[model samples]
Target: MKLIAKWVLSASALLFVAYVYNGVEVRSFATAMGAALVIGLLNAVVRPVLVVLTLPVTVLTLGLFLFVINALMFWAASALLDGFVVRSFLAALIGSLLYTAIGMVIDSALERLLVKK
Candidate 1:
């Protein structure tokens, strides 16, 4: 149930990102959902490998490199999907930041809601 809720909320967050950021474009709710799933999968699978491989740079940057990884994942999702588009690397960076912020809010709300029950 929690997973389902997170997926839906993540999709909504994607839509919100598109609405607020002109550089990111999502055609519809379904496209946003698909993009969300791709982003989640990339984060779950590719992200760890990237973190490990880029450990030195990540350390050198004082953990700031993770933001670049996040942006790459976001841009990769846009590349893989048809209806979801990120205009450029800069767009991807900003969009990823907005998406991450919204996701953090969703996770926090979910944690509070579920823990109280």
Candidate 2:
């Protein structure tokens, strides 16, 4: 299904981040998948609430503060998962940014490919 493909794309992005950054790591494919699920859930459920609560700062910063929220969610997922490790907050921030960039690219590509089918 589309959701499964999206999850796989996210996990692939996480794996790519782990490969690119020494400070971020995943013990296995399963761990990466788990991390993807946790990150997705947090983004879906918690991120909106945090965004609403921080709307003033977000508006003040021209939406830059959303990056901080994304980093926090990434770090929280690392803390919750035993096999996924983020060595520092900076690593989490970078990883979060990379994952977003990579996921967006992959999603757009997949969307185009699926539409042509």
Candidate 3:
């Protein structure tokens, strides 16, 4: 139940990102849902490996390089999906930041709503 809620909210967040930023475009709600799932999968499966491989650069940049990795993941998801488009690396960066912020809110809300105290 919680997972489904998170997925739905994540999709909505994607649509919100598209609506707010001209650089990122989501074609429809279904497309946004698909893109959200792909992004989640990439973040779950690939992002850790990327973080490990880029540890040196990440450390050198004092953790700021993680933002680049996040943008890459965001861009990669757009590349894999037909209906979701990120215009450029800069767009990916801004879109990812917005999505991440929305995701954090979703997570916090879900935790409060679903977890028993």
Candidate 4:
């Protein structure tokens, strides 16, 4: 149940990102959910490998390079989903940051609400 809630929250965050960025478009709520799933999977499976590979750069950049990895993952998710589109790397980066912020806030709120129950 909590997992489902988290997934829905993620999808909602993606929708918010699409809403805010002119260069990003989500065809529908369903497409946003699909995009969220792809992003979750890529983050789960691919992001760790990329993180390890780029550890030196990450260290050199003082951890800021993780944002680059996140943008790449966001763009990759867009490529995998039919109706979710990011027009450029810049758009992807902005979308990624926005999604992260939105997701963090939603997750924290949900955690607090669930904890009270």
- Pairs clashing in candidate 4? none
Our tally of clashes for model 1 stands at 0
Compared with the true structure, what per-residue lDDT tens digits does model 1 show for residues 1-117?
999999999999999999999999999999998999999999999999999999999999999999999999999999999999999999999999999999999999999999999
The parts of candidate 2 lying over 4 Å away from their true place are: none
The TM-score that candidate 4 achieves is: 0.97
Question: Can you tell me which runs of candidate 1 are displaced by over 4 Å?
Answer: none
For candidate 3, the lDDT comes to: 0.97
Local lDDT at 41 for model 2: 95
Model 1 worst lDDT run, 10 consecutive residues = 28-37
Residue-level lDDT of model 4, residues 1-117, one tens digit each, is: 888999998998888888878889999999999999999999999999999999999999999999999999999999988999999999999999999899889889988999999
Candidate with better TM-score, 2 vs 4: 4
Highest lDDT model number: 1
TM-score for predicted model 1 compared with the true structure: 0.99
TM-scores of the candidates are 0.99, 0.96, 0.97, 0.97
Off by over 4 Å in 3: none
Identify the candidate with maximal TM-score: 1
TM-score of 3: 0.97
Tens digits of per-residue lDDT, candidate 3, 1-117, equal 789999999999999999999999999999999999999999999999999999999999999999999999999999999989999999999999999999999999989887765
Give the better candidate number (2 or 3) by TM-score.
3
Q: Supply the global lDDT for candidate 1.
A: 0.98
Ranking by TM-score: 1, 3, 4, 2
Backbone Cα, N, C clashes tallied per candidate = 0, 0, 0, 0
